[model samples]
Target: MALTPGVLHVTQPVDGGVGAYVAMAAADQARRGWRVAVACPGTGPLAAELDRLGVHRLDWTARRAPGLSDAVQAARLRRIVGEFGPDVVHLHSSKAGLAGRAALRGRVPTLFQPHGWSWLAARGVAAAAALAWERLAARWADRVICVGAGEAALARRHGVPGDLVVVRNGVDLRRFRPAGPRERAEARARHGIAEDTPLAVCVGRVTRQKGQDLLLAAWERVAARDGRARLAVVGDGPLLRALRSRAVPGVHFAGAVADVRSWYAAADVVVLPSRWEGLPLTALEAMATGRPVVACAVSGLTELVTGGVGALVPPGDGAGLAEALLVRLGQPALAAAEGVAAAALADGFGVDGALDGLAGHTLGVVAGVGTGAGEACSSSRLRKTPDERGFDEHCQTPWGQ
Candidate 1:
């Protein structure tokens, strides 16, 4: 009468970055012969991918933001946990982080990944409440897996105590590899962009966080300098209507496309004008496609983008963003050279290594080895001294202590 070794991933947002992370982790775990179940909203791209991967799917109705109904969601999650009987429960983002911990209360091995701290995205009263909850509920999660060093630092600065670990985001190299001549031509043709035009593509939701408006402000300057320069903002969100209303002539809103690789292939430069991020997958996708990027110098991005590979400017600085974009578009030869360097660096952060690191951490927790500090809790190839592990130095105290 022993419980089977299984992992259950629970979350609310079933699209975008959190969705991608859940699908990748579940599929990787399933491939390794572990019984994996995902408890999330029963629709969207994430659910479809999980079904394709043959993972057990449990429908959970939860809102993106917290409310009184969280009690209902927590109850539902607890019931799913009972049925699945997993040894480990991985909570993704804030909604699931709250519900999963409340439901499980450390009854099972719990791994909570905030993706980005909730308070960072909130303000005033909501922000204070979020920080308070994170600090108080920190103990409910046995381990906290931060997606970037910036996120980890923010947690410490706000005193969200826990055993923190960093796992930088990565993407699938095979699917997002560099485009050949035929691909470049075909993708441009499909998107109806002239081959000679200098194209800069920004791929992400049209939200304040993604900074589409900031990019638009910069795009005005970029188009003024080079009339043939075109900017495409791909992906839709709550701000889509508002963003489109503010768009200038050279800016095109591509909406949401199934295969983002096609857009990446057609681009001369990829830009992420995010106000904040936990290492955007869009930048990695563009780099993998052998394109240089111009992005804000935010937490997740600072870890990945460097001067040789791409240009990083201060967040919300429209002038700075425009300057960086001009730097890439004005000198095609330099941009192409930087693209080569970007691809080389991006290859080092392939999905395989990330999958392995996740498996090691989850397996360690189930085996009761998670009580030790950081990598000492896991026997995966991810093990290295604190500095060598590439985590923010500020994260040392919580994980080490």
Candidate 2:
């Protein structure tokens, strides 16, 4: 009889996209009857959701940034790994990726997923250091799972070597679906938004990377052009207070909400002016909810927001950002048409497919199989039956090899 495979997911940011991804993956693994455990801080939505799902959780208190405590953090992680005895270790985001690899040191099958390359978020000496760390740490990872093709490309461009695979991020289609007129009206009423007001929703952590400041700068122009337009900046972060202090007219800071779907439903268009990303969950969720997106032309955003479905302005181009939002807000028919196309595109990125692809890779790694260097495998190519414990003979060669 085959023993149930065990997976341990270690993560640091336990609130935004990374946290949500961990929660979804852990829950899915548990439902499949695998022994799944998550090592994360005992706070935020990740911990709360894991507890609700009845998955075992170990308190792994770690900060978002590396510091003197990282050595201690790695030691604690090593101890947790010893106790859990997982068949595979999956580290999420940069902080966990850093500590997990250092702790395990390739002693076990390990997967490192940098939701976004840490170097992209750093500057000067910090950026160089981050890139160097990633290049060095690649040897510790059996497989580096990238959330999108752009992420994998970035790694190769920066000479970060590893067996890389792109598993495009997916959204919960059931939870975020197209909002009809009645549904839209109800969502607006629920959020206290006027039915007639032009609304553009931005959902993400209010940090430099997420670019709430860029959005606010663009909103100034958007408001100047159209006084009736309203923008809601959702989610909370360290920059929330600083951003709110600017006091841009017709802008509402919703803070952090338990549910972001209603905000998507209440929007004429969804906007993301992020400086960088690796297939942001906000863009996927908004598209799945049938809303047009006006985002900067960054890595992940460029792939998701095509010409027909939405507009992509160059990163930090405030005038272009404002123009894109204004075009969508002023032309409801065009926005609605683009939204229908957006929903159609989002159908191809269901959460089930993404999770299944991840499971296939996990099982493959446990069985001592690795995908070819820099290969991007989709769920369709990597799908396995529920009863399957590991890769079959056909899956041994890696997709497209």
Candidate 3:
């Protein structure tokens, strides 16, 4: 008899890194002859990409949290899980994770990937309620997997314990590897930048969590140091108009390009100035593209950007970030060296590592490694009625508790 391949993953738009992580995992699984199905909101680049790779994608969009839309999505997912007959449920994002676990409870083993916890993102009275709700919902999951060690630490801090898998996200080096000088030159020229101009790329959603405003502020400082230094940001969000309006000199918002790989190939440096994150794909792709990263030292950024790959500054320290950017700007040779080191560091985060880690953890969960059939992860933050104040409290610290 042959081993059966059946895996079900739940997520949202699948546009950003969180989405990219699942997409890559499914592709790797497919290569290994696993039957993987991803249930997300609707059709977009993510859905299309999954289709291209022959992974099943269901039409389901679980909203931010506790909305009528979310309720419906959860019901739909419960139905989908029954229909798919999956061996494991890997849920991504807040709403998807909570709802998937709730739906599959007492029947299927669940593994949740908190791409970024909603408990850490929500704030105020509503936030308190949300945090409490997160704790209540956590009881449904068999295991909570954190993509970055920082997030795994946070899971322990929050009380989601036992069998908590720390799986660092991965990148496809083949798709994002460094282009030849000729290839790089053509990409930069197509973007209309001189061959010798200083260029740094910021790739991610334009949101508060991603710290786009901070990048804008940092760009203001970078322009003061070198006017020739051009910053191009890829990806769009609610703040697109506001970010564009507040744009400083030498800043260009590319507005969510289709081929993000090209953006990496066209830059001398890449920056992920997110206020909060969990093994950001932007940094991974940049490193895979062999570009120096000037980023905030939060989440896994410092862990991955070590050894001359680039400079890591304190999360909210604007001056330190500016200084780091200037260091790369003034010394092209240094930036190139950093890029090489970054590529080497990023090589460690390829698809194989992430999938193997995820597979091992999921297998363990299926084998009943930790947490009882109906229990919760370690955390005082776990709640039933939406700990709005607690959620608010966590959200105040940009790093996300």
Candidate 4:
């Protein structure tokens, strides 16, 4: 059989990294003459985002615990697969992975991308139950596609032993480049921030894994020194209400900005203090946009934030986190130098690179394609921190166990 248009069914809401990946894949696949469509819990800004892209939508974000949601979604998607006749079903996030994989049931090839699993993110709130749920989801998978090795390892830890492909979260460098002077000034003006204020920005949902709570705490610590250090947060999540109340004296929450370029342009220092991650898109975006990043040195983050391109701090260390931010904010020349280093670093993760890697991986998963080789070696083998040691590259992680 010849490979053609590939369809991916996502059960999670259309938002965040998974959404971006689907869009890129859809556009690239369309250009390559593949019929691509995404059926998701198209509600809220994410649904609106999908509409802008002219994607196929589905009304099915019904609450699905590992047991109930999985059964309902799987049954519904089984019908969808039969009707749509897709080459493969690509599942995004944990919920979608279990549902989509189980629904397809080998009738068609299924690709599961655990874009941060529920177990890793859901702490103290029945986490063991989530893991149990994932073990069940893995049963229906053809090829498990992990966003990063950390995620892949987590999958393995939970008994998902099989052929796994790790297609990392990537960024489009062309759109997110270093700011030219005119554009930089205009962006600063739009934000009503002075170029001299030393802006710090964090882009992602205000959720637990994103560690906005930690960022808020760190913000207070940083502001205790340079009150001029302004914090500009981008993105919204379930934690928006509590995030709004954070009110770090020098921090400004921009809510969810459609065009985040202005914020990226205005920022001299960028931070992603996530408690856990698969492979964060924000760190790549910040590096791609030519900003100095200060991210936690763990998981997939250790893979990126290498060299002298960015700074890294251990996760959950509030004082260490504050010190890392302050060090960069205090030195304009050094921050600019790091930004330039980041610009050099950004060239590695082009959209073309991602597509070349992703398209093959994706199509193969759908069409039963294979490299006929074992899984790729993980960067975790390299024991080093993110700094002058050549670990401070593009910092992040999104999906987890």
Please tell me which predicted candidate would have the highest TM-score against the true structure. Answer: 2
The 10-residue segment of model 4 with minimum total lDDT is 386-395
lDDT of 2 at 47: 89
Worst 10 residues of 1 by lDDT: 378-387
lDDT of each: 0.82, 0.88, 0.75, 0.72
- How close to the true structure is residue 261 of candidate 2, measured as C-alpha lDDT? 88
Question: What TM-score does structure 4 among the candidates reach?
Answer: 0.88
Question: Rank by TM-score, descending?
Answer: 2, 1, 4, 3
- Candidate 1: TM-score? 0.92
Error of model 3, residue 263, in angstroms: 1.9
Q: Rank the candidates by lDDT, best first.
A: 2, 1, 3, 4
Assess every candidate by TM-score.
0.92, 0.94, 0.87, 0.88
How many angstroms is residue 385 displaced in model 1 relative to the true structure, after the best TM-score fit?
15
Worst 10 residues of 3 by lDDT: 376-385
lDDT string, candidate 4, 144-224, tens digits? 766666666566656756666666666787789987567778889998988678888999878888898998888888888
lDDT tens readout by residue for model 1, 1-401? 12336999998888788888899999888888888899999878888988888888999989887889999999999999998888889999999999998888889889999987888788899989989999988989988887766677677777888887666677899888988668889999999998888899999878888899899998999989989899999998899999899888989999988789989889889999888887678888899999998889887787667768889898889999998998888888988898998898788778887787777778767777654444623221232332224444433333323
lDDT of 3 at 20: 74
